[model samples]
Target: MLNGHEEQEGVNKFEEKDGNSKNYDESDATVDRHRKILHTDNLKLQDEYQRLQQQNNKLQLLLAEYFQRKKCESRFSDECTDEEKERCYHNTLAKLKELQEECVDQKAHFEDQLKKLQEERQKTEDMVETELEIFVVYKREILLQTMKRHGGKRVSLEDLDRLQQVEERREKELARVQLENIKLNMRFSKYQEKFKAHSIGVDGQHLIDYEELKMENHTYNEKIEEQKEALQKVKKKISSTTHTLTQVKEKLEFIKAENLVKRGSLMKLEAHVNEKKEALKNLKQSRDSLWLDVKCLRCKSGLLRNVDLLQDFEDHCDSNDALKEKLDYLKMRYVQLTQNCREFRRKVQYAKQT
Candidate 1:
């Protein structure tokens, strides 16, 4: 039973480690995959950029030539003789044919480049998938090696804590690396967008032959008619806008007049408020003075006496009561003496009579 329990404990420990290793391995593989993808993407972009830059330069030169020709024609159109005009016209036609041929060649070349890029992307995806599988197998090998090294013993909590601390430090380093990766990704994305925009600017989807050219001319005429309609609409809009502006101007003038009247009324109200405030101030001052006079009257009328003096007056009243009691005793003594004297006199008379 004890051996069985020990084996179970070992299995449980192995399970915990397997879970951690799996998670860590998965994360590492993802990071590696991202790295490889970015590297391949960068290579692809470099090649594409070189090609596109060359094409752009050629297109720019062609555009410059055409524009230069147009400028020369405009400058000399009135002065040039018919033979010179005919020569210039022939030269222009030849240049146009050459430009059309170049355009066709470019379109074909671009199609080939597109095919190559698609194949490369597919190849890259396949390579990444295979590499991922290899990485997973490599991760498993490392885990097996780790298990061999650790043997069947259960990992202690203290050891796990130490490992967790180590992992935290590693995570900090990983985070810094991820930050740099993110910055690089941002730059890459910006470049990608710029490349896309550049490609759009020089798009090859235009009239390639005489029929298409004629269709384009017809479209231009239709566009001109649309523009004329748009211009009429704009004129109507302008007239409506002018009417609204006049109404706005009239309303503004009315508002300004009303504002002036309001300002006059406000000024009057403000003056009245100031007068009331001054009156209130005067009233407050008067009330304060009256309070001071009332306090002085209270003091002078002896309504507010000192506590010690009141106590002394009470003591004096108490002494006066004691003196009054003594006087009443003395008067009683005298009455008693008078009554005794009368009795003695009566007794003496009785003795004499006997």
Candidate 2:
């Protein structure tokens, strides 16, 4: 009887121990389920964050590229040569064409990515909703069981506050993400507007205008060259004329000096001729006196007949006539000299006037 009682007591103890172990196993399983669900939610949030980060990076890169291109254009526009500008323009045009093609490709790629992201977001949202529903159901069951065990006691106020805080944090994060998405969309719209503007015929029109301007520039350059050549010829002619004028001025000075010397000599000759005329007048007066003396002697011939004295008187008269003829010849020579001098002076004056 003692042995049977011992055996029964051991069996009851084993059954109690098994029941305790089963309860512990059940609690561990519930904890593991909650942990797994939280881990999956965290992973989904991380993936979404990563995707947004990648998109932001892409947008930033594109913006940087655009700003760099604008800076290059502004720098080249400031002070480069026409050839450099033309080269830059062609390069810019080629780059723009490439960028346009890239933009088209990127637009298509972005559209596809956006569609994919939207679908993924919808799927994630559905999954989160289902998970939330399951969690709610599990929480309700736990709460009911706790209430039954604790005779209707509510959860702690601190726990409720903590949950509210978590919910607020989640809402804030969602709002931040939505704002970022809006900013990205705005940037994309701006890029599209830029692309559209570039797609117009502005480049073609500019090319046509550039060609016309080049033609005009060539023509203008040719005209400038011709003008320069004509100016050179005019300058040569002016230099030659100036040299001739200087030579003529030198010749005129030499001729003027010669004329002055000749004028001085002519004046001296005129004075000498006037002196000769005065001398001739004195000689003529002397001859007249001698003739009167001769006449007086002839009247006294009957009172005193002296042949020698008459003959001497006749010789004196003949010598006086010869002296008078010589005076006449000198007077004619003086007149001729005066006439020649006057003629020479008149010719010199005429030459000076001319």
* Candidate number achieving the greatest TM-score relative to the actual structure: 1
Candidate 2 lDDT by residue in tens digits, 32-110: 5654564465445545544544555565456566767778787767776788868967996797688668767866786
Q: What would you estimate as the lDDT of candidate 1?
A: 0.61
Give, for candidate 1, the lowest lDDT window spanning 10 residues.
Answer: 144-153
Q: Model 2, residue 336: displacement in angstroms? A: 99
TM-score of candidate 1 against the unseen true structure: 0.30
Error of 2 at 244 (Å): 99
Best of the candidates, lDDT? 1
Error of 2 at 185 (Å): 20
Q: Where does candidate 1 stray beyond 4 Å?
A: 1-45, 69-73, 137-354
Candidate 1 lDDT by residue in tens digits, 1-354: 224345445445554554565665676677577657756665665556555555655566566667777887778778778898789779878987897797678767866876776677677666666766665465444334343334422443344344445544554554454445444444444444434434443435422333444564566556556655655655565566457446644654464455456556666777898999999999999999999998898789772467777788889999999999999998999899999999999999999999
What is candidate 2's local distance difference test score? 0.59
